[model samples]
Target: MNTKLKHLVRKIRKNSTAAENILWKELRNKRQGSTFRKQHSFPSYVVAFYCYEKRIIVEIDDQIRTPRSLYNHAREKQLTREGFIILRFTNVEICRDLESVMKKIREKL
Candidate 1:
């Protein structure tokens, strides 16, 4: 990541959405048996959360179906091509049923 992207990542980390904050409580500090970085930047994308050791990227989408949108489809393809698994959960899902969300992430790890 370039300096600009690093700054952007920092900005994002400071101003996290409610859902991101809620999930971060569980994902931070090796709470899940692996370290996860929030607002992790790639060359062209800033992932919601990333686990470098497991090559996993967890994304929190605003819309429930945004994961299937064209842009996300292409992004997911590129990330998977790079051998990263992308897990997507919507804001509603995170706020409503965090246990299920954590369950899925645990399964991935």
Candidate 2:
């Protein structure tokens, strides 16, 4: 792993939020033959979850006020340009129905 990625992994391990912890529990140990790193950063961006081998980035959003749709669009565009396939899900969605989310992730992989 890169030095920056190491730092990011440390940060994630130390301070994962509830949603991150839940998802990590399900995705850890390369359960699908693909390893994932949390709080992975790339340039000016920090993704909630990243699977480098699969070129997949998953972001868990809990937007209560500001509409994140527009910003998400731009972010996805930027990531797409860099050859990343982005996936977004709401906190509620992930917490309430993690199986569905995991299924979606498996499909993407």
Candidate 3:
């Protein structure tokens, strides 16, 4: 990993959003025996959370202006090709209905 990328990841981990913090609480302690890394940096892009055991990437999508960005599509395609599952959740949805998000993650796991 590049020094710059590692720095950014550390910065993000320190300055996490409310939703990310809340979700981290649930994902911590190897929730369901699944260890999750927050602010994880992949070779292609930085992910909100990563589970190496299941090869899953969890992304909190807060920007609704574009719905989904070209960058995200490209990133998703690349991750898919790499055989990793990508899970995306809106910030509002996560804040309002976290149990549902957790349920989805459990199903994926």
Candidate 4:
């Protein structure tokens, strides 16, 4: 990653949302039986959480809109083509019932 991208990643990690922070606690430090990185930056995109060992990328969508939805679909297709399994959850799901979200991630694992 370039310096600008690295700085952007750091800024994101520093200003994470409540849901991201909650999920990060569970994904950090191999707590989920595998290593994961927060605000992981790829050459073209930055994902919420990524498990390189499993090629899994967890995305927390804060909102649903036409443009964002389209962008996410395209991004998902590209990432899937690269052999990644994308797991997306909403802020409500993360805060309302985190265990279910974790269960889904574990199932993927």
Q: Each model's C-alpha lDDT?
A: 0.92, 0.82, 0.87, 0.91
Ranking by lDDT: 1, 4, 3, 2
lDDT of 2: 0.82
Q: How many clashing residue pairs are found in candidate 4?
A: 0
User: Model 3's lDDT to the true fold?
Assistant: 0.87
Encode model 4's per-residue lDDT on 9-53: one tens digit a residue. 999888898999999999998998999998899998899999999
Candidates 1 and 4 compared by lDDT, better number: 1
Model 4 score (lDDT): 0.91
Q: Write the per-residue lDDT of candidate 2 for residues 1-109, one digit (tens) a residue.
A: 6777777768766976677789988778898679998787777667888999989998887754233678677888999998999888877878999999999999999
Pairs that collide in candidate 4 are none
Q: Considering only N, C-alpha and C atoms within 3 Å, which residue pairs clash in candidate 2?
A: none
lDDT score at residue 33, model 4, on the 0-100 scale: 98
Per-candidate TM-scores read 0.90, 0.79, 0.92, 0.92
Clashes of each: 0, 0, 0, 0
Q: After TM-score superposition, what is the CA distance of residue 34 in candidate 4 from its true location, in Å?
A: 0.6
